[model samples]
Target: MPETPQLQVQCDAMIGSLHINADFTTTHPWTVLFGPSGSGKSSLLRFIAGLWKPQESHVILGADNITTTPVYKRKIALVAQQPALFPHMTVRENIAFGTESNQAESIAQMFDLFALNALADAKPATLSGGERQRVAIARALASTPRLLLLDEVFTGMHRTQRDTLMQQVRSHCVAHNIAVLAVTHDLPEALEADEVLRIESGHISAQGSPHAVLSEECTAWIQGVTSLREKL
Candidate 1:
């Protein structure tokens, strides 16, 4: 696989009463956008995905200035918190939907990667939440995106399951030279990222290695856990 190119974004936007001004570039294969709810993390992603137009924005992927490109033309894939799988299509079909080639080899790879072989014939309505989320991710990757954006995709998954799935996805992305920018409130998830952007009040307060950027938060979380254990 070729080296993953840098993803650069500079944007200022107002959504509702929140004002967002973020300027950052992703130098690592997997970057985490860490923030509280309503901190404009999702808004920034929307701007980059061409879902929302900011007051002023510039998005560049690799060597191309894709600021004006349409959403479909961006070669970017976003899997939101809600798994939006096709109700009518089977799991296998859903995974194959985004892929242009719909190649059997690639589809089979996704099925194996997400452990969806058992559910291949099942419909969205018949699947568990985690199962659905896995299918959604596999669908996105089937598209073979240059960049993949994840918005709280592991919100309700078990810690062990989330960690395992993330590892698999990261390995797959790295193998394909796909850059990933994921949004999360989970400290453990943030800690796993190669780089992290800590956002506050709709602005980036820090950006660096996860440990360097989130040391304070990590310490507080550890203390909280210790206190809870003592009580129990």
Candidate 2:
């Protein structure tokens, strides 16, 4: 509603001559990079996050062109499929890492926001996959990221767990007005994204609402939504 946050990414990158030219803007708070494995979804995320530099690109967030900016200064947080938590630190410490001295309140909020209160004292080695992911997300949020990159974050969770956590992620992003780019090949995962960009063979095939971009490739989901609408 405020109309402030904006993300624009354009890249002509290559991984071992597997060329990929992607151009897209994240107009919505949550945009999904949906594609099959090896379609360069994760590669694109890496380029945006500054984990990997693209040859020719312009990545702008709000007023800053972060293409050449350092990773920490870009105000972007990436939570990979395997949660990268500090093995030695407790959950509380990990979540408070990016926050400032007034971290007591933020720690409490992360606990409540991600249901991590019960695991506050636990180390990364002792936490389950889902718990680790929750903590990673909390830590990222505590840092006050302007853009969040989620790469296959539901690998270790059950369907119900993934669904619940996804809802939480959406709520958190919306509340903070943080832009999110989620990479996934799962149809159901793409369904939850605010906008969908269909990537195939290192290129974007389509971009729109799920039902719109997926009409031909994913008629089943479209028909399912139609059936539900009819029932309502």
Candidate 3:
């Protein structure tokens, strides 16, 4: 089989008094960055999104070097834990915000694929948690991004909602041939990914297929959570 295209990032950043060093290249269709809180997973995602500049770094997506590329120019869409929708804009306008005029119909079709048609006329403030997340993802897809960065996007979502959203995200990425880097502390969520990476002390300590990377100890720990409806 041919090698998968990857997003390569090498960098160091300061977090509080600690220095975070992340060096990893991921080719998995869905690469989950798993770690404890403050392990720099969020920072790493932010760096990839061009939201945080590293002290010395190089970010290469496929053959393009986007280290200094502006956030808007990188064609990388980010979905944070909290849906950052524009409160003033209707869902339709938010989804079509930066897309070209000719792509509006196509974008709307994409939204329909996500079952977001009815909510298109609703404002952000009126939508429920799941609805807002779906809209956020729809907006991101409208950008026709090369990569999608998800940072704890499953937070605040019910189990069914989370599962549904994850399925949609997976399908969307595969259908669009877009790479994904999902950051999460949830082990079960990480299991849904093609590859799981564990970060600790500013470095990637373990990484492999879910069955390979997730330790027995970690598995046991997650099983204790009443919220995890299914086993990894």
Candidate 4:
């Protein structure tokens, strides 16, 4: 099957009290939005997810213009820093939520691939941070979304856990031909993406392959933050 066309987002929005304007055009399988706090990465992702409106924005998925589409109708899956799983729902229930009846078996297989089968009956409150994030991902994938937005979903994971999840995310996206836009302050994490976009003072300052963008001054600032984060 032909891969789904990657996203094309041009937005101007306010995050908290800050105003942001960003334009991105790329066909990368995985794109990383890299910036420190307050740079508007999360806000942009929220805009794409239909969680927030952009003052003036255009969102095109494949050939359709979904700028005014409602969140549920957008078919976009967002996994935030906090897993946001339902505490009362079992893993199966959470993953199956909003999914078609024919998708249940596929969702179970996905959970098993993530090694979350043992915790299928466990609630989010009782799961570890990594497990919750994994389940959250599984839930998102179960919906067969046209686009996936990941907002620092690996924030507190250990190196091993992070690496494992990253690989799984990449594999799953490729297999499903899903377009992914991930936001993070972690340089190493950003490095795993096929393309990286750097935002600062509410605008896109640089965008390209990870190595290309890493050489720019804005990315240098991001690298400084990443360095300090590693020290902490």
Name the candidate that leads on TM-score.
Answer: 1
Please report the candidate that would top lDDT against the real structure: 1
Those runs of model 1 whose alpha carbons end farther than 4 Å from true positions after fitting are none
Positional deviation of residue 75's Cα in model 3 after best superposition, in angstroms: 0.9
Model 1's lDDT to the true fold? 0.91
Please tell me which model should have the higher TM-score, number 1 or number 4: 1
Question: What TM-score would you give candidate 3 relative to the actual structure?
Answer: 0.91
> Which model, 3 or 4, shows the larger lDDT?
4
Least lDDT summed over 10 consecutive residues: which range in candidate 4? 213-222
Q: How much lDDT does each candidate structure score?
A: 0.91, 0.85, 0.84, 0.85
User: Candidate 3 residues 118-146, lDDT tens each?
Assistant: 77789999998888888888888888888
lDDT by residue (115-205, candidate 1, tens digit) is 8999999999999898899999999998889999999998889999898889989999999999999999889899999999999988999
Model 4: per-residue lDDT, tens digit, 28-68? 98999988898888888888888788667988888878899
lDDT of 2 by residue, 1-232 (tens): 4443678889787887677888888778889998889899998988889989967788998878988999889989899998888899999999998787876775687789888888888999988788999999999888878899999887657899999999888887788788899998888778878899999888888888977876675787678899999999
Task: Give the per-residue Cα lDDT of candidate 2 at 222.
Answer: 77
